[model samples]
Target: MSRRLALVIFPDFQLLDVAGPIAVFEIAERYRPGSYDLTVEAVEGGQIPSSSGVCLAARPLSQGPLHTVMVSGGDGTRDVEGLQGIVRWLRTVEVQRPTSVCSGAYLLAEAGLLDGRRATTHWSRTDDFARRYPRVKLDADRIFIRDDDVWTSAGITAGIDLALALVEDDLGAEVARMVAQALVVHQRRPGGQSQFSALIDLGGRTGRFGPLMDWARANLALPLTVEQLADQAAMSPRNFARAFVVETSTTPAKAVERLRLEAARAAVENGFDPIDRIAEAVGFGDPERMRRAFLRAFGLPPQALRRSARS
Candidate 1:
């Protein structure tokens, strides 16, 4: 008999939260035939509306004799009253069966399953979730977290990563690697991590910093310093530095470094340029420095990124 998986969708659910994990599970099915039987279930029996007002047809929760159950998060289900039924149903989940929630960890909290467990949720909800469920040890910085059979992800997209991890654990690392490859995702992202690099934070780049980020992106090859960037923002170096950090959630040096690193990674993966030239173009000054940075950031040197990207 194949394993059974259920995805619980509710009103105002983040559609990607529902889609990404389902896609991974579906892809896993392709590689290992008859591995799973999947269902999209709702706390209600049918036409549970989404945040977008589109009615999503789903099987009811009672249909599950599930090997794994996923609770998807959306704006519709965040409040305590909105998630009351799902939270109650979750309390009855079979202990031996793994129960995972995507961005829906907050719903789990409402029912008190997370009372003493270490967990994660969308970073934006950290303060509120902590306040609401004081006993749940929340790791706001992680992409996803797993405590025994209960797994939770940080936000919408991270659920896909978390689901792939569960697939890896259920089957094998190799199968997970293959699924990631097929999905065009980076392989082997461990649970309890930040999916997006903090270095890629383009936060608060709303005004002049916005166009400046475009400028920086375009001139990734140039030596861009704080003074230079400040001049472009038409502010004193000190003021610009403060504003940039406040807006970008990172220093000017770190932002420039990340852009250059991204450029170097792209150049490496494309196979159109040599490592030395790519390093120099991305402002690494030399291959050795770029090699070290690449190794540190990607766990692979330039050549390895090229090889893996090509393969």
Candidate 2:
């Protein structure tokens, strides 16, 4: 039986939020015939202009049975008053799986569907999302998250990852893998994987710690204790720790660990080094400790990641 899935959109919605998932489901259907019936929907239907100025033709919001209903996110979500209709519709929709991509989680939250549910959205919107929907457990560090029947993903590209996961859930891993290969993307990134690269903003809000971050990366083999980092930054340990968090939005210890992970992962995936050697070079000191860290942060062990990377 084909599962009916709808991609809900609004005016000024992000284009990829809809397109990425469309591509995933379309590819899956090709691999497993009659696996899915996909539709693009809007509150009033017709042509909806995306944030990038491109427009997509959509059908009127349907009251018919659907297996999954996914809402796309973009600048349109900022207009809270403009989306009341969607909020109301979402509240009454009887889809088996209610899902969202990026800021679309905002609508689900607005409709009260995500209340007390573990969800995720774009990393940049986490602060505002948490403030607006305190009842929703927002995990800022994820590509996507599923709480029972509700699924939410982070950012535009993460939508592809979310759809690939749904394909796997419905059509098995082989079909999903073939779809991913056809799409030229990873077979599937675990929902627990961090969405953003920590290196992108290691310097913090003002780039005040840029030099320190670079130095830490270059010296990942050394123990990057707070005191050692503080000395390098020319500040007392206590004052440095306090200021680091205030500036970076992360503790010094966490920042160091992220830097090490970034370096270690690169070596693990791109080189033929032993896991123990890679772990030691990245300051993890022990192979088992690095494996645990990899599992916690990536939902996969070092060995599994290595094999996936090579495959």
Candidate 3:
């Protein structure tokens, strides 16, 4: 049986958000001819301009059963929440599964589809998304999330990751691999893989503890006690802990652990160093401790991450 795949786009929608997933399903169809019948659509139906100025012609929102419906995200989604017609159409759509790429989760959230659901979006929008939609469980670190029949992915290229996962779920791993290979993607990153490590944003920290976070990231191998960090930030330990949580949205120990985990995972995946050596170098002290940290952050042990990276 052929499944109908509908991609919903709006004015100023992110181009790749629509193109990437379409390419994945299109490629998958080559492997299994007629596997999918694809359509690009919009609420009004016409040529819609993307954020990049490229235009995509789309059909008007049609009434029917769709195997899957995906919504694209961009600056336009901010306005989607206020469009009564579009919002009403989204609320009324009947589909076996609904999905969103990047900030498209905003539209789904606005339509009440993501209430009490686990979803994710562009990492930079995590705070705003959480603030606006407190009903949604937003995991900023994930590459993508699938709760029941709904799927949501992080920003930009992560849409490709989500499509590859869908292809895997429908046609099997072999077909998904072929699609990924044709797309020239390195590998199908697991959904559990983090979008990015928090350490990378330390330089952009705006709080009074900005320099302290930079120092902490650089000195991940050190003990990095709260007192030490407080001294670095020129504040009392109690005040520092309180303020740090308010500014960074995480505890000092957790921040340090994330830094260490990021560093250890890089070494494990990209270098020839043994697990114990990597652990010690990253302040994990022992392989067991690093293994536990890896499990907590990535849902995979160090060895498993290493093997996946190599494979």
Candidate 4:
């Protein structure tokens, strides 16, 4: 049976939020013919201009059966008044899965669908979303969150990750992997991965530490103590520690650990290195120590994470 997949959009919706998932489903349909029937719909049918000013023709929201409904998010979501019709429809629409991308989570929460459910959206919207919908348990760090049948993803390109996951759930990992290969994107970034990398956020936030972080990544096997990092930065230990915290809003030790975690997790997921070897290479020193770190940061042990990545 072909699953009927619908993407909901509105004026000024993020174009990529709609295109990315549509491309995933479209490619998956090619691999498994008769697997999916795709539709784009709006509260009112016809041309809807995206945030980029590109327009996509959409069908009017209808009472027809839908297997999955994904709502696209963008600057338009800020117009709460204009979204009432869509919100009202979502309140009553029945689907196998109800999902949103980026600020689209706002609509689901507005419709009361996310009440008492764990969800996530673009990091920039987390504070506003939390204040607006206190009942929804918002995890602002995830790439995407699947809380039972409802799914929510972080901003923009994360929508591709969410769609790949949906494909994996429906067609299995092998097909999902092939679809991703066809798209020339990574097979998948597990939903549990952070929406943004530590190095990118901290390194580029100020150029002062970019070289240090890069050096630390390259020398992960070394003990990246604050004293060493301070020396590398040409500052005394005390002053460097103080200045680094002021610049990055995190202690030097914490930043180093985050950098280590990023490297270790990548190696764990993408390579077949033994967990102990991986831990040592990433400066965690002990397998158990790495396991604890992974659990605290990613909610999974190394082996479990490796298994999920391969799957």
Using lDDT as the measure, the top candidate is 2
What overall lDDT, based on C-alpha atoms, would model 2 receive against the true structure? 0.89
Steric collisions counted per model: 3, 0, 0, 0
Residues 1-311, candidate 3, lDDT per residue (tens digit)? 79888898888999999999999999999999988999999988899999999999999987868888888988887775555566677788888889999999988888899999999998767899999999999998788999999999999888999999999999999999899999998678778776654523453235566677678878888899999988988889999888876666567887778778878888998999999998888888989988887887777898988897788
Q: What CA RMSD would you report for each candidate?
A: 3.8, 1.9, 2.8, 3.9
Worst 10 residues of 1 by lDDT: 192-201
Identify the superior model by lDDT, candidate 1 or candidate 2: 2
Sorted on TM-score, best first, the list reads: 2, 3, 4, 1
TM-score of each model, in listed order: 0.77, 0.93, 0.85, 0.81
Candidate scoring better on TM-score of 2 and 3: 2
lDDT of 1 at 220: 71
TM-score of 2: 0.93
Candidate 4 residue pairs that clash = none
Which pairs clash in model 1?
12-50, 12-51, 143-193
What are the runs in model 4 whose C-alpha is more than 4 Å off?
A: 198-212, 215-219, 222-255, 265-278, 291-311
C-alpha-based local distance difference test score of model 4 = 0.88
> Which one wins on TM-score?
2
Model 3: ten consecutive residues of lowest lDDT: 196-205
